[model samples]
Target: MTGPSKKTERETFAAYCCDEATIDLLKAAAPSRGWSENMVFSGGIAGAVRALGAMPCPEFLIVDLSDSEDPRADVQALAEVCEEGTVVLTIGALNDVGLYRDLLHAGVHDYLVKPLAVDVIKAAMHSAEEAMNAVEEVEEEGPASEGKTIFFIGVRGGMGTSTLAANTAWLSANGGESTALLDLDFHFSSSAIQFDLEPGRGLLDALDNPNRVDGLFLDRAVVKPSEKLSILCTEAAIGVVPRPAEGALEHLVDTMANTYRNVVVDMPRHMVPEQPEVLNTATDIVLITDLSLSSARDCIRLKAYLKTCAPAASVHVVLNKLGAVPAEVEEKDFANSIETEINARVPFDAKAMLLAVQQGTVIADHTKSGKVTAGMKAVNSLFTSGSENADGQKPSWVNKLLQRKAS
Candidate 1:
């Protein structure tokens, strides 16, 4: 969000073979999303690509045949010129369903009408990646490869939400899971900071040119924390506001859901409009809190509200800062108060937490089998367990209790 411009690791490039008007729009939109290099060849689609012999075949390609006198021939020739793995996106002048269907049937990844934007491009790349991954998975083993989307939300301020989210991504990535840590807490987001990365350009710039959002933009925006874990964060809190475009939060969650085996969101506490999108889509929503009275109340309110807004998402409440002695409020009482299971009770370790925060490390990484690390392992187990219900709704009593308290 409004962060500094991030460089791409993969040298993601794009080829835009379109007419003058489309070329101009694409040129203006490409750089804001931090597209590494975009080449616009203004000529008939077939001839322009044929000239290259796939010289600069991109991970993704966009072509506009809006003004072509022979639309069918132009499309066929463009398809013929594309390399085997290159994904082609076509922007057509027609709004006819038949035309759209035909293009899709002819091996086009996606078909957009005139006046395309970068978001469309990004969405197409995500789709292509998903399709390719699916094929790869099928080839490697079978069609049963499990995909997971997890959202980690801090029940209150400074409960180590960002750290846990980052570690979860690392765990998944290092364990051969494709993981993404998405930080949407605009002003005070910390995913990049924890990894010691300077705020770089990311989602904010992409929103400026939503139509041009693509895999290249994503590659440019995300910074690799490790070989396995990649982070997308709000750039440093600049003077400009750091808010996602309308429905952008939803789009982001949806895209992450499709691409990675594990999607971890470092969510803001305030349940804004897009909160539902992430919570509703998550395989499990982990609400982290401490064993304080305030935290318990907040957790209760969160569970209740979630029941209303995202009935299908399972809410797993975790009590952080658990010490040797039990919390003043008994665990059973806490669970009864919230009307849900207490997924984890992460122990308190002043030294571990302080060291981890000061050093910007996860508790699991900084310490051995201490109390804190053990609790973290327990939390990890909850994720692996089959008890989680991705589509289960909370009981109505949970909502009624929260409403009464609100009144």
Candidate 2:
């Protein structure tokens, strides 16, 4: 049997069954789920094998094996005629345990023993939809070379979240890994100003139409200040914020996470509620704050939120601009409020930072060796290293956080 070509654009759903009863059931339930019932036909496994040989296989396929003398052999034969990525369901008369296991082993997505109930068919349809969605996620994420998606957010505004995020992305790329800096804020972007590059409309285009977000789409939106680093940032009009496209940020980050070794997101606090899924996908969460009482309280709030949404990712509480604010809350008290020790502390250096801004460059790049850069280097190292405890064992990220608290 000739297999369906991968190059052909496949239809959404189709079914071939031995009896009119099954076809009628699919026709009734299919339209409710936005599937076309016209694709439903009568003929069973032989029909599927015959029709798919000439046409492309659909994303979801169901075939009847009720009339087959040898179901296992027929399924194996059917696999030869379908292309990869086709999710198949089999309906048969027999309910033997061995037969169910054999059909699944032969790559059937699900098996239904007739007569099929309405709810059971609908449930199977939902499961197949989830399966198709999962396949799409994997395809969008690209190769098996998994990349880390790291998010940096401030406990309160003007706490240097973007500064730390941009520098971390730069430092990560300086180490020779492919890195992407994703500024999620459409208005008042800080990364472009820091990197000395103009913002592009590619992010707006991608957010507006997720279907157009691919490597080329990203290439158009991103600007590379260094060979290994790619940055996507924009400054939209102050009062205008467009509605977020469904699954746009998810698809974009998934594509970038697989495409690069690291993705550093400069996430505004508003996005925590707007796109919580972005936080959920992060491999690392960096919470930037100062030593003030407000910072301490919000650090507690943001850390608690991160646990609910991203338990798998490590939560890092960074004390930025240490000693900058007079009458600042004591370090021990701030740590007590959050119930977690500061993972790293970046001391304040106004003159050096202003000098770098004057030169339109990163402080770490301008002043290669300083106490400020030293603290930054420590934070950057932890950002790339992930949730590894000092014991060299990979433990639960929560446990690692608790260990930091206990220590």
Candidate 3:
């Protein structure tokens, strides 16, 4: 099959076809479309891959997937080699609606059934040119806000850490700050389920390949419950949990924080000592606990650990499910033990919480003025607008000062 010659100059349009008819149609349309006739090649997806891999991808590209073994996977491979705004259209032999939708979801500009018509090719190219122009306009606007990371860690299990984290992200996003809820629990995460969404796949790949994670990967991997809120979580099968390689988790968080205005991490407390490196750049670390003697001890242990690993992070305490059961310990006593005051206390509102859980929503949405809802709002306000931690406590500054004096 004929293929593209090694050309040093970048082309505005390029086409790779498997048949003589398709090649002739593209060549005929090239002059009118301001494309070089030599850019049209008689090789299919394979030749497109070889040529594009060597040269910069054209502004508009058409590849014949008529011979592609797995078109969706092939398109994804093309995405890896292509720059951010390279508009791609796939011409295939099959006219299946399922494949069409799958290709769109995989980020192809459009899919065209190949019979080789100039009008059809030109129309698709026009739309693609518009799409590329739109991307350029957006890039001209400015970069997105590089946001802050807020980690919600429960001192012990059954402390509503996930709920608090999800609600905090929801409030932040709904209040017009685009937010990302990153649930680090590989298996048994409820962040997506609680929002009535299926947990997105590919979080494992993202963690393992942080350097490769980008907007395209996030668009496919994260579940967006609303325009502003996105959730990245996974329910991996029961197996040996993959610990993020050294700085992998941190890199992923940094990437996400660069995209959204706030990143609320639903951190499993077990990961505190296990993956402490991920806490490196956290702006705030809110510790959730109950009024129990054991939880109080765990809070102390966690506080000590945070001081070592994330000393720059300002820490806050949250007492949830107050009065759910008899007083194991007084709230004041629990706070005193941890050497911090309770930032937010969400009392046990069984009716409201049950309604929210059953309806797959936050308690604030179900019972707007209920005590529990108010408590959740209070938790959201912790990082609503601040550089320091909640309640005017700026321990991060203290840590910086102490470091300076030590030097």
Candidate 4:
């Protein structure tokens, strides 16, 4: 099958890999090789085929056949939809020489096995570049331009949503990323207090008049506890209803996105008019709940609400306070009951958690090792690795942190 004639332009590259590791390797290796920002990363071969079938193919394409039943046939299917002069690279789990030869003969530019090192992937990309014979410099997009907002909400009150959000943002900041923690609780927020910071008037001012919320105003409004961390919160008077201007939350989140590498929003349990807008702007949503049947039921309802409100945002359910869970509901049963997998479970640590709250700090700062810390580390890994696999495998960084705590 032939596609339209190739328009003369700088060659672009796109990839649909089976896992996050390969995607990370590609993102790290792309920039030094002059690949343009027109890159697309999706899930495996099926996603690549579906996405590219409707659009003009890039000069270079990479797809994974690791999960394919017939690798050769999959490549052949991809070739049928690919335009002429496109260099297709395949990565798979199969390491057989025959399979490599078959893929090469089926119009695949190259085939590499899984467990590939960065250097190997870079070499494969370079080969594709050489095959295309198209090289040009492309502008680099900074992290701020691609900043992501993560929303954390409790499935029920007292689920420790603020704690998770605070620590996640803290970890992001300490991990060398500029991070912001926005507390949207309005009246009763503890995010700022958790960081040992006083509530600032910036959030209230922004909510009152979103039209005046520019980058400069945001910069001045946030409280910087560290070089990379900023907090935007308010302790508004109780009984005072907050009527944020129509676009106030969006404007604030947008401005924060443009300024920080990561933004963590702590959403209140009660749904406000701005809740939908905040969820819609988030790249991820962390719904915190306990292991109780009531929390699980509430989680299902909240998950449905998120699906309807912010369909694009990825939602992860974190089961907190696991120590108090009765024997009547097991984790598996709880997940089944909610119709969603429990991404991370934080064992209840009443003493440590209470101390942290009393001291206006996070558990990580209060206790170095325990079930709670381990769970928090695992939760942080989900964001750092940017993997939706939810396999509950702690990242290497988390392991290092635990090792230090043990020592």
**Best-matching candidate per lDDT:** 2
Which 10 residues in a row give candidate 4 its minimum summed lDDT? 135-144
Choose 1 or 4, whichever is better by TM-score. Answer: 1
How well does each candidate superpose onto the true structure, as a TM-score?
0.63, 0.62, 0.61, 0.59
* Candidate 1 weakest ten by summed lDDT: 392-401
lDDT of 1 by residue, 248-346 (tens): 565555555544556788777875335564466666789997666777898878778777767766678887766634566877877777777887877
Cα error, residue 53 of model 4, in Å, equals 29
What is the Å distance of residue 353 in model 3 from its true position? 1.7
Cα RMSD of all models vs. native, in order, equals 12.7, 13.2, 12.7, 16.6
* lDDT measured at residue 308 in model 4 versus the true structure, 0 to 100: 83
Clashing residue pairs found in predicted model 3? none
Residue 333 alpha-carbon offset, candidate 3, angstroms: 1.8
Best by TM-score: 1
Q: Report the candidate with higher lDDT, 1 versus 4.
A: 4
User: Poorest 10 consecutive residues of model 3 by lDDT?
Assistant: 392-401
- lDDT against the true structure, per candidate, is 0.62, 0.77, 0.76, 0.72
Error of 2 at 201 (Å): 0.5
